[model samples]
Target: MNGEDELEELDEESLHDSEALPAERPNPLIIAASVTARGGVLWLPVAGLLALSGKKKAAGRALTAAAVAMPIGHLVSLVVHRPRPQAANIPARQALPEHPDSSSFPSKHAVTAAAFGTATALEDRKAAILVTPLVLLVAYSRLRTRVHWPTDVLGGLVIGALVALAQAGIGRSARARATACRLFAMVRPVLSDHSCPSSVSE
Candidate 1:
């Protein structure tokens, strides 16, 4: 064959070889982020750590946030029927094998991440700073994996933040009530003693 024909043949073979090659795998970091974002993976460990460190209130808040966020997310998902990227015929790189058979309106992972992260931050800023990246990664991973739309993730964040704020407010109110009760108890005995002597003298 002439040089031109030989070059053309080599080019065709190279093209075919490239096409036969397997699709590139997703980044390891992205995979790790996706896995860590699982409902019980990241937040559960965090809560456990907080409890072990004697930060019981912070731990309780974290657990409460997750518990509340997950159910709310599911309830919203049930109300809004949105398809995942792949199901909607949009191009997506699914990193995880398990495709959840549920509406993808709001990512539960994002909700849990935001709720847990926000609650923890409210209780401990330093700890929040440490976990902030993981929380962001979890949110990003949902998009990167194409399991959730951007709006879904955004909605999840907003809902999670609201839940955290509500929980924080409740905690503060409970503490305030407990303090008031303690103060009233402390003064009640003094008032009773004075009134009892006055009545006896009368």
Candidate 2:
């Protein structure tokens, strides 16, 4: 081919290649999910609403669960040095431009989601049903955004659930103790009255 012909051909090929490459467009759904997955974003408002509605126990549990889950997730990430999906050369898109350069195993977002969901469930099943979809979406977003592996999400879920369960168990135990004390207090007064009357009659 002549020089001009060759130049034309190269230009055409470049145009074709550029057209073939897909542009990286921002996904609004993924972005929304990622934002919603934040521990504070989901839990804080829910807790506040619950408190305003006089559901203090549910609010307390949800906040406590998220608080407890965060440290545990951080501790696990420290112990397990796993790379994020993108760092591992996996084909994935990150929803956020900035992310922590820490171990990807056991996603903190997932942990917080699970902990808040489970604690809410323990307090109010109906509220949990509404919250469950959000939790699942948060977990899926972590994977979709290439921030966490499936195992990381799973491990976080397990940790969160366990923490919520432990908290619920403790609450139940405390309630049982309180109930026993209340019953004893009521019965003790009755017994004292009977004994005094009997002693006076004797």
Candidate 3:
């Protein structure tokens, strides 16, 4: 009935309310997806496999697009300064294993994955089929883990696709071929150590 007694009762009610909220559980698939999105680890093997399969040109183009997308997306994120879902007080079912130090406007993971998938698809439709699903999964994972908002992934997708389109268009040009030749020449010493096919130069 007194003020102290009333305050104690209120505190108990608040504690009960807080305890009623469900705790977030971790999903194995989501954990794997989150890890895959980090540092372009998933795409490295994909690119390496393409190179090993003698589609080095295609691999190069895809990787080039991914490389381009990463910095562009990061710059955009810096300008946008949009907080991630958690930072914005938007609840995520799960959190990243290690939080990123960057802003989360456009998901770099989505951008790189999308760019890689789109570029690979441009070179080989069959490989795209495999890559596209993985890209989508990475996008979905960002949402599921609450690292990015829907629009963040969408922005990344758009940028990535555009970069891939540009790379594919350039890949068809004589200038790009010349550039590739020059690039290959610069790395010839490294290539000499490997069994690079003669056709890759041609």
Candidate 4:
């Protein structure tokens, strides 16, 4: 099949995304060597350190977002039980790892990376900058590792955004409480004066 046609089929994960490498190259050796060569490895431990650094509330929120999103993605994986692309006649970029092999419809790593990114962004904009690319790389690594299709990574991205939004919404409620209190203070006296009964005007 031509490259474009191969991309369209679920047949190539049309549900999540298209995770194809360059159609020009096909060497397992090269794919393996380059897969983990980028920021993917470094970001995981750094994110872990950020998580374990005793920032309990933020960390809890982050973990919760990740916890919720990943299971949802995994549920998608379990129900679909989509075979690893490698098993389904696609050319796997690298040999599959022996451990933790199962359904890969949605990437957990991508979900966690996104959760981490969203949590960090709540505190530091620069940290968020560092996180965005790492999340993308982590997704790419899965493709090179030969266990998933591109759509799986894409699915993770969509799910991750949802997780981030949910986490943000919880925080938004907290902020609204404080904001409303401040806002009310400014208009409270006027409200009290206006609220006086009309008979008092005598």
How many clashes does each candidate structure show, in the order listed?
A: 0, 0, 0, 4
The top-ranked prediction according to TM-score is: 1
lDDT of each: 0.73, 0.73, 0.73, 0.59
* Candidate 4, pairs of clashing residues: 9-12, 16-151, 17-151, 19-150
* Cand. 1 Cα-lDDT: 0.73
Report how far off residue 123 is in candidate 3 (Å): 0.8
Q: Model 2: per-residue lDDT, tens digit, 29-146?
A: 7657777666557778877887887778888898898898888999999999987654323233543655768998788988998999899999998778777887888886676655
TM-score of each: 0.76, 0.74, 0.69, 0.60
Q: List the residue pairs that clash in candidate 3.
A: none
Task: Pick out the ten consecutive residues of candidate 2 with the lowest summed lDDT.
Answer: 14-23
Tens digits of per-residue lDDT, candidate 4, 34-97, equal: 3442323444455566667655455455556666666677677787676666443334432433
Roughly what TM-score does model 3 have, to 2 decimal places?
Answer: 0.69
Error of 3 at 180 (Å): 17
RMSD after CA superposition, every candidate: 13.7, 14.2, 13.8, 8.5
Model 1, position 26: C-alpha lDDT score:
44
lDDT assessment of candidate 2: 0.73
Instruction: Enumerate residue pairs that collide in model 2.
Output: none
In candidate 2, how many clashes are counted? Answer: 0
